[model samples]
Target: MTPLISPRARPLAAALLCGALAFGALATSAQAAFNPPIRMSHGIEYMSGGIGSDEAKLMETVLPRWPASFEFAIKDHQGADFAADVHVTVRDGRGVALLDNVVAGGPFMVARLEPGSYQVEATLRGQTLKQPLQVVFGTPTKATFLWPAGTDMAAAGTRAVQ
Candidate 1:
């Protein structure tokens, strides 16, 4: 049997294969690291995540376009730390519940909501915090919910709130 590939082409073929495999791996990892899963509930679209540096950067860039955005944290003398496993609820001005018990997967959340008044309730570790929001067209409404200093947020580590 005769060799199909010339000896001179073997090295170039191997290099090209290796480069293609490396590029595939890099693209896959970059996409996973940067894209947080967007979810839908009760006709509303939302996303929650800001755990790592890359995801946080992605969230910051995308958040402004959302009608509603929320941040969960623990603030105290030691400083502030991001929080997770937060349950959130949203209600319209009439007090009809739109979202109930929607747990956030990370420290930040963004939502696409109609322009109106809303009441948001975020619960963390048995404590619930409530904030009223006014979501308007062309303006983003932001809310931050903070727990007391003693809360254990070891999963998030410690970082200054940006």
Candidate 2:
């Protein structure tokens, strides 16, 4: 019959409950964001992943720390969709391959490279896109490779025809 919480303390209790709920939400999101593990190849370190919304958010958060970042997508009438299983190759100015691998985890990748001129080649559905890039100190070199639509590699089960 009697109120358990005094009128003077009701606002404080409500505020505490709200704060606790907010903190719980924040903890859940922090746990949801999956930060891909950093890998090393030939002394260069890199990480690749952006498969889900939370992972993508985590990727964006660390974009500024890497010297080079690459994003993969496929263009369509509605815009583009993130792509995976892209074969990416990074070459130095002398045409020596530094990082040659396939992105099987996700579509976004960040790499630590010395500031210099480089060549990036990304292949999807047997179609390759090449771009020249210059990585500089104190700046992150960003590149996005977008393939044309209709090249649904998985659905086609073979190389996409021109």
Candidate 3:
């Protein structure tokens, strides 16, 4: 003798299967919608030697002005066989400092920043190099400082003289 399931039982099984599938689809969609995308903010690429004396001083004062949790990049020039210590300072349009004392070399120190206009400064070797850099919100920005070989305070002063 053969046995058969009742019509009611068949409907219940079908309903259960459909409910499970719906739940799975909803879970998948939710995960996809909530996932955050990767982003980048600041980068500094140096060529020639590195940050000159003037640039170094500027960076020291600028980096601390940025809000906490910002991305940054620093690339040293490969042509010159010299190492440089680079620093950055960030400020807002109101002349308020946001970030300071950010230092890096080689291909390290990448970070992200909040969306806002910022003034950036860079320094190398205790000398101010570049200042008043403008950083727009939600946009990737960069600052590069080139240091020639054997740059001395006197030489830098003379260049300023010219």
| TM-score for each predicted model, relative to the true structure | 0.78, 0.74, 0.38
TM-score top scorer: 1
Off by over 4 Å in 2: 1-33, 153-162
In model 1, how many backbone clashes occur? Answer: 0
- lDDT per residue, candidate 1, 2-34, as tens digits? 778889999999999999999999989977779
Q: Which portions of model 1 show Cα errors greater than 4 Å? A: 1-30, 153-158
TM-score of model 2 relative to the true fold? 0.74
Whichever of 1 and 2 has more lDDT, that candidate is 1
- lDDT values for all models: 0.87, 0.80, 0.44
RMSD (CA, Å), each prediction: 5.0, 6.9, 14.8
Compose the digit string of candidate 3's lDDT tens values, residues 22-91.
Answer: 9999988744543222333244222111144444333333334432222222223434322334565666
Worst 10 residues of 3 by lDDT: 153-162
Candidate 3 at 65: error in angstroms? Answer: 21
Quote model 1's TM-score.
0.78
Candidate 1 weakest ten by summed lDDT: 151-160
